[model samples]
Target: MARNQLLNITIWTALLAPVVYIGVMIVRIQNGEWDLLGPEPGRAVTQFLGTWALNSLLLTLTLSPLKRSPLSINLISYRRRMGLFAFTYMLLHLLAYMTMMLGWQWQDLNDEVVKRPYMVVGVFALLLTIPLAITSTRNWQRRLGRRWKKLHYSVYLVAALSMVHILLQVRSSWTEFVVYSSVLSLLLIERLLNRQKTA
Candidate 1:
């Protein structure tokens, strides 16, 4: 296979690992494993999906730097898949929160959005992703031309919003949030340096 083709194959194959993981999670949920029940059960799934979304976002951001590195393999093409996967996980996370936590009750949903600050941040992040996700296509890129780049830069804001949401959720535990934020900070610094170098 051509090099990029082989890379794509590998990318897709690697995605299946998440499928298996989610399947196992579902089995555990059904089996009442992890002491997940009632409110906790829904929260367990939602948190799991949300965690993947955060990781996916980080991975998507990381790919740009890797593409510029001296590594033999280029990962640019795989970024689209990673971005889409991130959005998928985000959507699922929201759905789980809505269904499991709120039980699809509109009144409760409204209250959650209004009363819970983290929920507001999460919803805002998801909303911001919609435009980026919609314009991810080559057709949209061609259609938007230079404007496409300006629009996509919102990913940084999305990342910030995601971090805020997570931080709000994990107020006491700084380890995971600190690590992801540090990596994101590095990515931002690298991007700035690269832009300056190119200029």
Candidate 2:
């Protein structure tokens, strides 16, 4: 197939992998294979979805830098789909937390958010992603014109906050935080250097 077509297939396959995994988790839970998911499946799935969402966000941000590479594919065109997928995964992450962790108890969710600093940061990031996802379409992009680029810069902040969210939750391991932070820093620096060269 064509390049875009191949990219599309790859994107869909990447997106589907999480869905299939989640389905298997649910099936195992229903089939009394709960040991596989440990004691708290909701918590397990929530963390998994959050990690996937963050990974998608990283890929979305990485596309711009990839386009600067001499060997880059037509990946820039795929950024929109990648961003929307990030938002979709994050929404599922929140829902999974609410359903499994809080048992859909609005009061407990509210209390948890108030009591937990990390929740506030993480939820704020997710909330910021909402507008980005909504306006990711061609229709919205055309309408917004120059302002769209300005608005989409929120992704950088969202990524930072997401890193902080996980960082605060880690008790003993700093390795993941170090790796993600370094990668994000490099991407941000690359973007800035490119902008300066263009200017």
Candidate 3:
């Protein structure tokens, strides 16, 4: 197969794998095969989606630095798609939390947010991701011109807020915190070094 075809296949597979896994998990849960989801299926699904969203966001951040490496494989072209997938995962995470944890009680948002300040940070990160995802198109790039770059820079903030959100979670382990923080720090440092070299 051609290299581009291979890349497309790889990208689609990576993107769809989570969706398929979660779909199957949901089916299993519906079928009373609770072992897959364990006890408290809602929390399990919410955490699963949240973790993938964070992973996807981190992957999106890695694209620029990867493109600078010898093993890039032209992956930069798919950064926008990766970012959109990150947002999709985040949306699902929020929906899962709302439906499973809160029982879809919209009015409970205030209490939940107050009870868990991390929810505020997570929701804010999601809000920031919305504009970036919406304006990710080539047409939007052309229309926004220089402003587009500035707007998309908010992704760094989103990434930081996401880390903070995770750190604030009482159930988040130190190991998880260290791993994510290390990855984000390394990615940010790579971008800074690259900027200095270009300057």
Candidate 4:
């Protein structure tokens, strides 16, 4: 198979998996199964989205390191697409929190963003994603040249902020945060090692 075709399949699969999961959750809610797994619908939905956001972010960060493995070179071509999908999930996460939890109330939105540190961090992460997602396009990559990479480096900041966001929200659940932190650490270490080798 062509590299692009494989990349397309990977991208679609990654993107669709989350959509399917969310659809199933919605169906369960409609069927009155949501309460069976949680104390409240709002909490369950928020938890799902928050977990998905962090997972997608970790997946994006893993792509580069995984590409270094001989068996995983196919992932390199799809890294940009995967990163964009991560941003998409982050956006959905934000939308879910706003629509489900805050109910689109302007005052609630203002108070949450101003009073909640985690919410602020989440918003910052989302904003950081914009440049990376926008530059993922081939045309933008060509137009930006060397600047393209410098701009996309924002992903690291996005990842860090995302970690902070999740950690603050979970407060007690260190398991997910630990897993993501370990992955980020390994990816960063691999990047540094590669830089040293090239230098």
lDDT winner: 3
RMSD in order of candidates: 2.4, 1.5, 1.4, 2.3
By lDDT, highest first, what's the ranking?
3, 2, 1, 4
Q: Stretches of candidate 3 above 4 Å error?
A: none
- lDDT by residue for model 3 (36-126), tens: 8777888999998999999999999998888888887457889999999999999999999998899988898888888899999999999
Better of 2 and 4 by lDDT: 2
TM-score of each: 0.89, 0.93, 0.95, 0.88
Deviation in Å, model 3, residue 182 alpha carbon: 0.6
Query: Of the candidates numbered 3 and 4, which has the greater lDDT value?
Result: 3
- Which candidate tops TM-score? 3
Q: Candidate 1: how many backbone clashes? A: 0
Taking all chains together, the TM-score of candidate 2 against the true structure is 0.93
Record all residue pairs in model 1 with backbone atoms less than 3 Å apart, i.e. clashing: none
Q: Which wins on lDDT, candidate 2 or candidate 3?
A: 3
lDDT for predicted candidate 3 compared with the true structure: 0.91
Q: Which ten-residue region of model 1 has the weakest summed lDDT?
A: 32-41
After TM-score superposition, the amount by which residue 135's alpha carbon in candidate 1 deviates from its true location, in angstroms, is: 1.1
Candidate 4 per-residue C-alpha lDDT over 21-108 given as tens digits, one digit per residue, 9 for 90 to 100: 7768778888978675477776667667667777777777777777777766546666776777678777888887787788889877
